[model samples]
Target: MALKRPLSQHAQIIFRAGVESVCGDRLIRDTVQFGPTEIWFAEHCVDRQAIDRIILVGAGKASGAMAVGMIERYQADAASAGLIQFAGHLNVPQGCERIPEHLSWPDDLTLFAARPAGVNEPTSLAIEGTDRILHWVSEATPRDLVVVLISGGGSALLVRPADGLTLADQLQVVRQLSGGGADITQLNTVRKHLSAVKGGRLAAACRHAPMISLVLSDVLGDPLDLIASGPTVADHSTPHDALEILNRFDPERSISSAVYECLNQAEQQMLAPEAMSNVTNLVIGNNAVAVDAAGIAAESLGYNHVMQSARRSEGTAEEVGRHLADMTVEMLRRDPSRHHQDALITGGEPVVRLIETSRRGKGGRNQQLVLAAYERLLELDTSEPIDFDRLVILSGGTDGEDGPTDAAGAWIDGEVHRRARHLSLNAADFLRRNDAYSFFEQAGGLLMTGPTGTNVCDIRISLVDRLN
Candidate 1:
């Protein structure tokens, strides 16, 4: 008899390994090209004669680094040109300013301060400084090309209320939609309509000036409008769309007073002479690039497997897990003479909404995904007699962190739950509390990769091979 190899087991390991490799510092550097400083120099010096001045204004998570990079390049180039004494220093990019501290206006010209801890951390932006970021963007002028260096957090950071809206009103709307389980597209649709810079309004500001946008997209499909709320891109969202999202997901929450007024004002502006005229935005990088880079590494390592489905995935984390699990089993059964070294990879972000009264558990979406796959595997075992020992299921966030948990994600064999039972921890109980972190820790299934600077949604890889 030919040897019977476990297809799922190998697939799981290969996928996890791919994700870890891509999320590392090395890959991140190769993938997200054009440091802020580098782009600044390139953009400014592109046509020294035609463009009188290369004004640089950088923003987003990478702004600090981008500014620094641009400044260095400018200094080097000016030195080569024999211009010994340029007006600006070389240590930092000229025209690039550090992100301003949070500025909230209480009166016409008076402002209040609300700087919090973890100012640059993910949760910190989600909590504070969102509106301030928008105010800064809104302050840009027509003399500027408005080169926006956008990354993942741009959406939250580019927080501005539509005309007549207060910071509190914007925050309330954002909190309700985000906390209510609205998907990214839907959440951004609302964000675009409620902001001065988002959804092409910022682009509209420079109706007569040239504009260039270099975006590092965190959205699954690299949707331009959704990334950083599409500040430099035209918005397809309308006030109606924004209202629809709020009504569909958060009808109970009263619209903040500021929010209501902003919507009303935007209605009038749509009738204005110029809404979208001088905006050109480009998504220079995204999760797909990361996924492709990871896939290439896998192929180079001799995996030699074509991705089964590269389509961006949606729905809940559990649903994605169930679907992936079923797909893995189906692939193994259908391809009898399949090659010994084949794998399947998929990338996308999945949503997980917590109920109001339900306490969030320790794990992020990745752990939950693995758990869901395990349940599907168990169902398969119970419904019919089959060998599952060789199969593996793996899922993880590409950012290397999930839902405040120490572990990035998990890897599991068919015996995962069985082993968990052996350790006296109920798999279902842990999952019920949204605590995949505990379950995986006990089962020795958690995978850790600290602080992968790149954010590329989620990556799922499955490897299956026939026995020799």
Candidate 2:
């Protein structure tokens, strides 16, 4: 059964199909398999007799599913090898195990509910979980195989403050950087310097053990050292880089004194070079994976699909929205015959620079983008001869959570302006207040999808259909 709303139903189907394509479980299954004499994963093969133990240590929004996938793959091989001993410790967002149809793993793997589901901030609980993971990694020997699952949100899910820093201090720094609109790279640079587990420290703890990190990339460009703050990968960023980001984004210097001191100390005593001789980091899933899947799905629905590379998804939310709307208008004009269906798919996370207001409103980056697009469409000259009903635009966070709102994102068509007028709502006023949630709620445009158990950033789609 489809959702009663036609536009929403179509958008939901396309987006869900895209997300499912890069799910940790599916990626793991495709990358790992067991042969009669060797265990094969990606391009690497391990002789069954050469490994003494399998140790699983990871933290992220998708790590739980990744852990489950690994366990299932190995369990299937247990009958041939006779009881493969494995111990796992993973830090996952709370309630991840509750995802519908999520597979259950063996009792040997211990799952830690690190951060509260839907909230991306680090907490004391996440710190404890990171400690446990570190302990497990430290116990690994050269004969053991260490598998690390790193994905989006791992930075927060596996929180461990550096020496002389408290969790509260780190939280304050994160809150400031996030509210000030610092990009992922900037935020992670600061986080890596201030954390005990990030910036390849986790890899250092593994000592001489052979380690493989299967990562789901949420950062644009799929920078291995930036995803999840690169806990198991070598970091190229320096302490001065973190200090620069903090100073540039936090002009007021309102960051706690302890954080300032930490950065200052880090400038002189930065983390040592990571040992990479024994580590292999593989990016198994990324925004491109999801975007390509979405393009295929759109084509299957009889739409001519054009995809924007994952790198093109960057920019401010409003600017990105206007760009998509303008692109749609141009496409319709070129196809005056209106005899074909077209879909444009894009992937990347856009920033939302919150406006300063006495009263703050609720909304996320995706909602803001759709709202801005609606406004841009309304301002287009009527002489453009574009039929609004035949076009629909959607932007959503692939993780099923956008910003601080429960909604993944929002969708809009030509009718949004008329509906807003009937309600006597000024779209500009809502946009100024950064309250796309209320505007969409009244206009029937919000797209709500609870935690999707994965994160690869955001996806946007614009569909134009032939006039009837």
Best by TM-score: 2
Per-residue C-alpha lDDT of model 1 across residues 1-468, encoded as one tens digit per residue: 222554444554555555444332233233223322333322332323333333333334433333333334444455343321111110111112232243221121111122221132223333244444334334544433444555555565555456676667666776677556677788888888777667776566554445566566667677787886887776666888777787787666577756756665676555232455544455555566656655775576556455532345488888988888887677566555545455567777787665454675677788888887777766786776444454566777665667666666887764565577588766667666777888888777786764343455677776554444
Q: After superposition, how far is residue 293 of candidate 1 from its true place, in Å?
A: 2.4
Please give the CA lDDT of all the candidate structures.
0.56, 0.81
Model 2 lDDT tens row, 320-354: 89998998777666664644677889888888887
The 10-residue segment with the lowest total lDDT in model 2? 1-10
Q: What's the lDDT for candidate 1?
A: 0.56
Query: Each model's TM-score?
Result: 0.73, 0.93
